[model samples]
Target: MRQEPEGYAWSRFGQPEYTNWLDESMSWKETCYIGDWSFLWQHRFTGPDALKLISDFTVNNFEVFDLYQSKHAVHTNKDGKVIHEGVLTRFGDEDFMVHGRGGFWLAYNLEKGNYDASVTNEDWFMYQVSGPNALALLQKLSGSQDLADARYMRAVTITVAGHEIFALRQGMAGEIGFELQGPSSIGAEIYQAVLEAGRDFGIRKMGGRIAMINHLEASFPTIATDYIPAIFDEDMSGYREYFLSSMPPFAKPAYINGSYDGKDISEYYRSPIELGWAKVVTTKRNDYLGAEALAAEKQSPKRVLRTLEWNGDDVLEVQRSLFEPGEHFAYMEMPRDQRGYMWADRVEVDGELVGVATSRGYSYYFRKMLSLATINVDHADVGTEVEVLWGAPGQRQKAIRAVVCPAPYKEDRSRGQLG
Candidate 1:
């Protein structure tokens, strides 16, 4: 099947860039940005066993899940590999909604499990406004103290554009950001209202091209880009069949490009712990799926997530080969791939394979080519030098020098802590 081209998400609503991507890239940090994410799959689970159903499948401990609070829910297979993960928000005692690809997996389990939960695939428009002035911009529109009172990972309903919407305080840009969500009926209205009201605050409309750069900088490992969903293994054939037949085509048949080519599909699969999401995975609960394995793996994770800064000179040499050499290295797109392909390159230490690098992108703010890599924990310390073998295997390749850094290349300010 033909893969979804790059910029697919952005093109669904508007152009890849309203202003130049370079400027738009800095919006969230310098001023603020408003980006649409209405395409994310959503599912509403309600009934007495709603929390139980979620708790049974996910790694998070809902023992004290507060109303209107959100958790990064990670669902793993029996062997502790992540099948899907998303932001799950508890709206009420028995009502919850989750956003992302995990909805399908949750829905499938709801049908198979002996739970009293009923899930409804709901539609909503999710636009995130984030940055130093993100709250200031929203403050102009809502004029409600509730906006300022909202806590991180918590949702508060406030009126926006004459519509009562749920504003979730969560920042993907690692800044103070609020995700405005409501029925699709008021999507355009609220979207336009935010844009118009944001003019004074210097709100920039983010395009698809630059939207994911924040994800890279913030170290949010995406499903296909950072790691493949754990649904293609032999043990998961049942769910795979269900996923292929029921889920969207783009979510199926995940493709990997660049240097890291492992023989088995499981090689691409990653656990939440490997992705530096250990805090979200609780080992106290043994009832959840993959609890035993996750608990054991959490104690001694073989590989951990880190950032690799590619050598500028060696990276430029690959680009220079295009003009003079008979055989040119693969083209390096600026600011990252727009095609949404998982650029998994191989990371080596002393010419020995130690890790796989994914989500390679260029940060205009940092002016460095960076990628998130899941590598052996022994060599994951900061400033550890490694070589990233760019280009595909069996094809012309370049061993670019790289240095280890923090997974989140940028300082995190998502917790509403502004200086």
Candidate 2:
């Protein structure tokens, strides 16, 4: 028997559930919720080449990148596969802070390149307050109407709990949201303030158990969850060595499971185009790394991201199999996918593999089981019916029926429409 892979490894914030998973999961949609993401890695790049350093490898155009603006930066390998991605906020003409694994990639290249840029590992607190009433809660805490005029993807200085911090309007829940970032020492203080002020607004503390549910419903394909980083390939062996030796153990050795096993590791990788991030990639500049490959891919992309609604009856039948004797199917974890590993399933049409399904979870708000899938462009259409292969290979696999739906199964209210 194969050893099952573990879920994501991160320090827990308070308890696994402040209330309950079900109620907490629904808070983002019905009311509001705050989740701590301070565990994410951050790096500050400074000097004349800061923007140039990022622009050289990332797909985003920086010709008109405004001050105090944040871009969902994406870095791809020579083959046009995504290596790392995250939000990068510009603080000054030559100063920037990027969150997530993207920083690691940037830092590595900075050391090897001849650029005048330098990077420092930063420590900070990141908390995302999102939902319909998210902005109202922030306004109450800051006691200012300035946030009401804050543009999407722009960072503004706000005083909260007597401490000033940068609030970037970046929503990850398909609703209006803000990410408050500041010194690590004051993270706890501001968190308590937000919690206290949010009581009347029905705010809930989001736990790790159901944290990624918002990402699923909003069509955000995460790094380790949706696709593995592109650094593991043999060509990137040097960087891989540096990554393993320099970073913490939990960040290394990403494992994959489920039925969509591929022949080569590259098969598990994804490009910006395939991941529905084409708008951010610019073909105007041909000098960046992998620009040629990405341009060619842009001309003829193969896969596209989408949502899959698993048949409720079929999902229930898998659960029902536990009591009735025969070979029991793999247990379907409720509300979200297993945290530690990439739980990718095989998506097929009439027995022919067409796509890979991931981030499988149940949404209480919708009362349906949904998963984000990268399907073949030919079969990637709303209302198209497909099948999701559940359980590991040779382990009572069941082909559960599913339907292709909008990439963001929920209406996207993240940008330009704040109330």
Candidate 3:
């Protein structure tokens, strides 16, 4: 059997067993599931200017963030194109841990030698405890009923299974979830303790495939797939070398396969508007890395990321109708279209090309097909009729009708209640 990650358990039993367990536990019953997110890059930034550096680099205003409060941050290029996105948790006045995608971008910033910031990758383990009964399970494990008092995004130092750990009430499952992060040495103990506590709650371990599909329901965008890194010209050469050398072997094969959209890397760059990040970009703040360009783009916003629900029957019929079968439907990547490298500003409307679709997925829970696309502001209004090219040119090409709608088609279910 292949060895799993340091903090993960092998789910080689079978796909159906694992998938069914996750689906049932996460849906109807109040159950908990543990996920190993240790592969995610964790950085510790400490220095008086650390906060300032983060504010200058990301679209979210970090000045108002209080200690122990976590917020989402997005780093954009000078052209307002999205480079990296993650969650920033403030532990102290000058200390915070940035979690999620974009380790390469963080390393590039350190190599630039521009600020007084010091970054240290933490040798940590992340465990996501999610489900309707997560809080009860955690309380039972830690022997502390105060687990419910820990508000969302709030971090508290707690002891679990006789091991000290930091528990953050954050997750991508769109359910009541908490991330338990601590040293690797004690990871197994923590996992076992949680499992023991969750025994009566029907807890199960989830794989990457289960998590990936659930993230789509949460409308989470991953780096390297949903967007590309924004390497400055001066840092490109060094960045490329680092990415090639430092990436895990499992990721290397995919990187070599390039053209995630089956087109080109240039088609992978996207702006904040195209990734459903409009609320995070604040132009009123002082000059930032992408202030000027983003400001101009905001005034005359070309495209906005909106969600679309595919007609289920129509999509299924098309697939079943194929006799000899044809190329499977390609999910949206970057630029939304393959005619050429389409930036946020160049998208048009009417006789013009309005926008580009970025990420698309089928929601099993909602029983609907959904996609996130960036379109011209004129056509961004909800309910606006739009046409999306179904297939590539010179193939079975056709325009599919779609309606403009708010992103996160399942918003209510996502933010309903904390377990």
Candidate 4:
């Protein structure tokens, strides 16, 4: 089994048990899980131009994020395609930790060396406590519920079982969740304390298998899984070396082979707008890496990202009817074929297709088979009819019924008022 960084115990899935805890925590009254976010690159920027530099590189306006507050940010290329997306936390004047998908972010930051920011990829510990009784469980572990009032993306330092850690109210699953970030040295102790405290609340460790499955319902896009990494300009020599040296074994083999427009695999690059990141694109800022290109694309975005629901009966019947029982219906990365650089086209519409269907999974909670795709805006209106082609040429092209719906097909119960 692949062992995670210190403080995380290995699971039968070869991933850490804490990942499984995240999935199990949702159903339980209260549950806690520890994650080794060490693999996520960490950078500290503390200069006059730190905020401005980041603002110029990303789509979100950072001026609005106050100290102790956090918000999601997206880094795009010259084409405004998504390179990296994560939570940007404000620690002080110009100090912050941007957490989430980092492989491309680290490379992009290195390329834009004009800034005074200092980036570091080191070992950091992160844990998540979630569920209906999460606040109470945190209180038991930390000796205080001061964290309960902390709004989403807000961070606060607290002592738990003699260990000091920074707790942030943020989670991928739509639940009352808190992320505990601290030194790797204290990870094991902190993990044990949270698990012990959660015993009475029915918390258990989680694995990545279920976590990947649940991400579809959470509406959180996985970097290489749901979409292709945005690679701007063929001069990726620096990026190639960085990936070879710094990328972790778990995150390596980045490319999803044969998952693009043609079988060649070089035709894939997704912009922020195509990935359903319009809210984060702030035009108020004068300039950024891909601002101009994005602005033009925005006027008439070639493609769009949307959620699609498969006919329930069709999905089940297929599952039961597979003769050879091939790969269990994993998500497809099929691209729309259009004339020139037109965003991926909707299978049903001749309009430009910008995005491809990235994630598709069975929502056990919702009891429906749903998919997330990035297509053209003209085809994005909710209730719009579309067709999903299955199989390859000859034996390929079975049209499946699809409907355009909200990005998050699953209802988020995490934002509700807690007792």
Prediction 2 global C-alpha lDDT: 0.87
Which ten contiguous residues of candidate 1 have the minimum total lDDT? 1-10
What order do you get sorting by TM-score, best first? 2, 1, 4, 3
Highest TM-score: which candidate?
Answer: 2
Output the better candidate (1/3) by TM-score.
1
Candidate 4 lDDT (Cα, whole model)? 0.61
User: Which order, best to worst by lDDT?
Assistant: 2, 1, 3, 4
Residue 388's lDDT within candidate 3 is 57
The local lDDT score (0 to 100) that residue 74 gets in candidate 3 is: 83
Per-candidate clash tally: 2, 3, 3, 21
Q: Is candidate 3 or candidate 4 better by lDDT?
A: 3
lDDT of 4 by residue, 320-399 (tens): 44544554332232111111111222255433343366556555556566778876677788998776554333332345
Comparison by lDDT, 2 against 3, better one: 2
The estimated TM-scores of all candidates read: 0.96, 0.97, 0.79, 0.81
Q: Write the per-residue lDDT of candidate 2 for residues 1-419, one digit (tens) a residue.
A: 12355554546344567799899989888899999988888999999989889999899988888899999999999888999899999999999999988898888899989899889988899999998899999998998777888899999899999999989998899889999999999999999999999999999999877887888889899876788888877889988887768766456645677888777777788998888898998999987888999999898888899999999999998999998997999888777655467788999999999999989988888898999999999999999999999989879988999999998998998889554
Q: What stretches of model 2 exceed 4 Å from their correct place?
A: 1-3, 6-14, 417-419
